[model samples]
Target: MMGSERSRMLYERAHGLMPGGVSSPVRASEPFPLFIKGGKGATLFDVDGNRYSDYCLAYGPLILGHAHPRVVEALRKQAGEGTLYGAPTELEVEMASLISSLYPSMPMMRFVSSGTEATMHALRLARGFTGRSKIIKIEGAFHGAHDSVLVKAGSGAATHGTPDSLGVPEEVARNTLLAPYNDLDAVERLMREQGGQIAALIVEPVLGNIGPVLPREGYLQGLRELTSRHDLLLIFDEVITGFRLAMGGAQEYYGVRPDITVLGKIAGGGLPIGIFGASEEIMSWVSPLGKVYQAGTFNGNPMSMTAGLETLRELREKGHEGLFHNGERMRKGLQNVLDDLGLGYKVQGIGPMYQLFLGREEVWDRAGAMRSDATLFKRLYQGLLHEGVYIPPSQFETCFLSTAHSQADIDRALGSYEKVLRGLRP
Candidate 1:
């Protein structure tokens, strides 16, 4: 058995100090979570001296892989200069320019600390711009922990939502409408019924939270048409998909554009960062420019800007093409292993991100993803862990590949997977 005695002891102590013994809910696992000592390239080393081939990639931020030399060198240089200045810097301007060049829809942007902040600010901007009070969100899409978006769909389809969390007030939840993802008819009906009150329709171009569920063909285009027709803003929560999907993100990959875009995760280069942007006319309503107020002390921290700028430059110079190719190679290899084992499982996702669902049906939305067998998934998780392949503990999370992962790394991972599956089968 893996020697996780140190991890177990640490968790026992942490359990008393932190809720569920983890700063984040997803970090907590049965028994105890592995305490990682460090990571380099595509591998992670735990406190117990166990080495794992990391497929989770720190929940999709390490696109270039852990502690990449360029990112580390950039951070080192920035730390030598200063970390945070709490004022404008040339680095921030450069970073913004790079992102804008890639995503022209966002001609201007404001930086914050997390994905939650980006989505929250975007929602507020949408409301301010339209002079409306309501917003429509995908049924199971997670935009962040903010109260306004922390909602669940009601009993009936395309109904007003209820607070998905304890602290969110019912009144706040009621202003948020929920519609099933990839269901244009449901979204259309909601807009027709509540068009006057609605400010915007926010969606994840590709659903990442529920294990990489993809959009139906023409679904995003359909949303753009509907929102334009109804005179409502369209917000793409690209927090998870940004940078990871492509240089321009899901909008570029799918050939669609949103009025306002929310970004985080990979853009931060493993640092905490969030960004929301729109055209000059729309963003004119923000801060000193106009009336919609938003400000943050760490809005454009030098360290984050340095990291993000370097990461983007590296991606453009040496990683983007290889990343796409490696991702497809890994996905096809995993699918082949499943085929060889005669397992009735479905693989979902696009580009460099993928997930193995313990179900046979193609998962195009949250409902189908949830139908995956959790019990079987738990066993696979445990088996993979024993084999030194560390994927996300939850079945409802996607696995990411990085430029650092070579063909050898993928082959090793496939070998581990095959061994685990063979042991599980009769």
Candidate 2:
């Protein structure tokens, strides 16, 4: 199928109820979303039989790539047993243990259905433990669509945050403090201003929502030290970087630990799963162990556990051979090719995730990231999509690479990118 009429018809029907004709606002792109049939390895097929070497990888959950045979087989087997039992299973313990072992910050964990739930509960547990109402979150850092995190730093990243959403109550957003990513001084200022009121500071160890902006040198260690000096808890939102950064996560990468850690995306293999864990002392503040109440009927569902467990097992077997360093090699090769083309661009990434920012501006933070040439980036994205290399549609979002992607796939994308940049230039 080649942009067949059926995809258009489907979008038309979807528009009647689904706002923007998509479930998530971010997924709605220029020329509308593409409807896909099925995927195998790293490739996806659309309704019109168009095929692409997908780098989006469902926004980083499919590190093993789309419909991985091992994960698919496990899902099928679990399907035969049952879907959801609503009871504890040995698989839950196994997966949680695996994650805990990888990220030492997570000594104990609770499984939930989505990253949103993982972060939402983390906020609650922090507040309950500290009896403090305020929380510090990095600006432009997305921790799900939760109200507390939906705030922007006032007058840019230097000031306290203001509500970013319409319905998020002022009282709720007031408890949320914001700072720019990669600026530890801003974090220190917030700590001095609201340390007593603040219960915890939550951040994406590596910002993924706005490409893969990494921490500036000494940024993570500074935060760790500052939080320790003050009486506040540090939280690492590792949902996107958890399993992909190494089988361990970003906290492991930086060698800086947090009081609580959030896990999602890659942890699920490809299914929907979220987890938050910490030392026994901090986790004890959660329900049953303490007054903080966090519960989900679908928590620790067997399917997510099975998916997470199997994915970890597979990665363990591979011994980090194909999962991450492969992505690094691909990124370096693509960057070198872009440099040869004399294209003004930058590759902001870590491990298996990356985003191509078409600009000369040093993207140290979100403001810098916004300086990219949107028109050129859009053209490049569409050009690649047409040439059978699928990436995230927006310049603001990061694209992911999976083990399913090959050197040939990277070569193809680099060649297409070079050609497209030249075309868009003149």
Candidate 3:
């Protein structure tokens, strides 16, 4: 059994200082959350000196894994020069150019500090461009923490049993429309009724927040067609799926492009960053160039640029085929374990992202994902922790596989899953 005496003490100390004893709601675990000291590659070393094979990957950012030498070295060099400059730098130009090459849909983009800022700005730009007040968001697709997208949100909001936040005014929430994932007809119906009033439709192409639920065949293409037909902008929130799914993200992977693309997580190489982009005409609507008006002090910081540039270079050289193969290996192993144990749990994932719904039902949407047994998931979480493996504590969050994860790590994780799951079988 793993010892968490130090973690318990730390949690107690943190509880008085921070809400729920954590910086983020999703990090709050029952009993107490493990206080991690450091991580190298695919392993995390907790404060209690226990090492865990990590699949959470800091909630889907560390695509190159923790403290990659290349990224770290670059950050170190950048730190020696200067961390932040109020004025623009060549790093911004280079990074944007590189990203544009990968994501052809984004001919122009603006950098921000977080995914929330990216989505928030993108929506505002959409509203400004379309002269519409309302926007449509898929159910359980977590764009960010901003008020407009909070209604029926997923991730921490859904996991904590409050999908709709209290602080958001009814008027603000009203402007945001909700549609179920993989339901093209529903979106079409909404567009018909409120097409003129709606500014855009923002969606996570893979539904990473709600269990990495995949889109049905032609679902993304259907969305593209519907939005285009309605004259509403399409925003792909690739915060979780960005570089992890493919170098070009879900847009390139699925061959369906969005009018505006919001990218974070891996795009910054584990640094705090967000980017929203569109065509030249649409992008002209932002800042001094246009009426949308988006600005940030830390936008395109040198440190984040350095790390991101290095991370991208590593990815291009290494390629994602190895990661994809590992993902398939893990998923197949998980399914085999469930089958052998006569467990009816469903495994869902794409590329290096995955999740295990705690029931027989295959989840295709928010409602379907909600059918998973959270209670059983809590047990499984504790079991995995005891076995020295770590995944996101919330059932709603997705698990990630990083390039740092090796075949040995996958096999070890599978063994831990099998052992812990076998114990949980009743």
Candidate 4:
């Protein structure tokens, strides 16, 4: 077992100062969260001096892997020059151009400091553009922490058993409508009932928050049709999926274009950033152009722009085929291990991200994801940590892979999984 005395000590010290002993609720774990000392490639070293094969990958941002030479060099160069200007720079323009090239639906985009900010601004933009008060979001698909979208959120919110957070006004929650993911019928019904009042329907192309619940066949197409028919904006929250599934994200991978796209995670090259984009006409509503107000001090921070630009360039140069191949390798290996062990649990995901659900039945939505045994998952989580394999502490979250992860890493993970499963077997 990995000795976590130092981590425990830190958590103990942090308990009094921070809420839940961590800045992010998801970072807090049962025994205590592991305090990371440093990370390189697909590996992380904890404060306890133990090494872990990091499947969490900073929750899907380190697609190029931690501290990639290109990203590091770019950051270093930007740091030496300037970090933030509080004003537009050439780098921001280049970054925006790159994103637009990848996602043609987004002719104009504005950068922010986090996915939460991006989603919030996107919602506001939708409301401003459509002159409507209501929005529809897939239940269990977490857009961000903002009150407007917190209704029935997943991810850490799901893990903590608080799908709806406190402090969000009831009126705000009432304006947000919920539909089960992968259920076109539910969404259609909702649209029919309240189409006139809804500004947009925001959804994750794949439900990353409650594990990787993929869109049903023709579901996304149907959504596109519905939104178009109703003259409502369609927002795809691709924060977790952007640049991880493909260079153009789920829009490219699934061949469905949304009216507005919220991007973060890998787009920032593991730094803090968020982006919301739409057609030129739609984006014209934002400040400095039209009435919608949105601004940020670090909206176009140089360091973030430089890192993001380098990350996108590297991803483009390498191609997504390799990343897909790696994902397939890991999935097949994991399935083989499950089969060999006679475990009924299933693995689900697309591209370089996946989840191991503790149920044999398909997990296509929040209901199915809820069927997973949380207690079993907690045991498995601890077991994996003991084996020096680190996945997201919560089963509700998805695991990510980076370009740095090799076949050897997959094998080692599988071996550890086998050991853990065998031990847990009755």
Q: Which candidate is the best by lDDT?
A: 3
Clashes of 2: 3
Off by over 4 Å in 1: 154-157
Clashing residue pairs in candidate 2 are 1-48, 1-49, 2-48
Better of 1 and 4 by TM-score: 1
What CA RMSD would you report for each candidate? 1.4, 1.6, 2.7, 2.9
Which pairs of residues collide in candidate 1?
none
- Residue 94 CA displacement from its true place in model 2, Å: 1.2
| Candidate 2, run of 10 with poorest lDDT | 152-161
Number of backbone-clashing residue pairs for each candidate, in the order shown: 0, 3, 0, 0
Candidate 3 residue pairs in clash (backbone atoms < 3 Å)? none
2 versus 4: better TM-score goes to: 4
Q: If both were scored by lDDT, which would come out higher, candidate 2 or candidate 4? A: 4
Best by TM-score: 1
lDDT digits (tens) for residues 296-393 of candidate 2: 88888878888878888887776656656656776787788778878768887877777788779668788887778877777888888877888888
Misplaced by over 4 Å in model 3 are 153-163
TM-score for each predicted model, relative to the true structure? 0.97, 0.96, 0.97, 0.97
Q: Candidate 4 lDDT, tens digit per residue, 1-426?
A: 569999999999999999989999988889789888999999999999999999999888899888999999889988999787787799988999899999999989999999999999999999999999989888889998998888874543321223288888877887888887888887788788889999999999999998898888989999999999988999999999898878889999889999999999888998999999999999999999999999989997998888899999999999888778888888788888889988988899998988889887989899899989877888899999999999998889999888899988988998999899888853
lDDT of 3: 0.90
Better TM-score candidate (2, 3): 3
Query: Which ten contiguous residues of candidate 4 have the minimum total lDDT?
Result: 154-163
TM-score of 2: 0.96
Evaluate model 4: give its lDDT: 0.89
> Please, what are the lDDT tens digits per residue for candidate 3 over residues 1-426?
568899999999999999999999999999888999999999999998999999999998899899999999989989999999899999999999999999999989999999999999999999999999988889889988999888885444322223388788877887888788999988898899989999999999999987799999999999999999999999999998888788999998999999999999888998999999999999999989998888889999998888889998899899999999999999999999999999989899999988889977899999998888888898899998888889999789899999999988999989999999999853
Q: Candidates' lDDT values, in order?
A: 0.89, 0.83, 0.90, 0.89
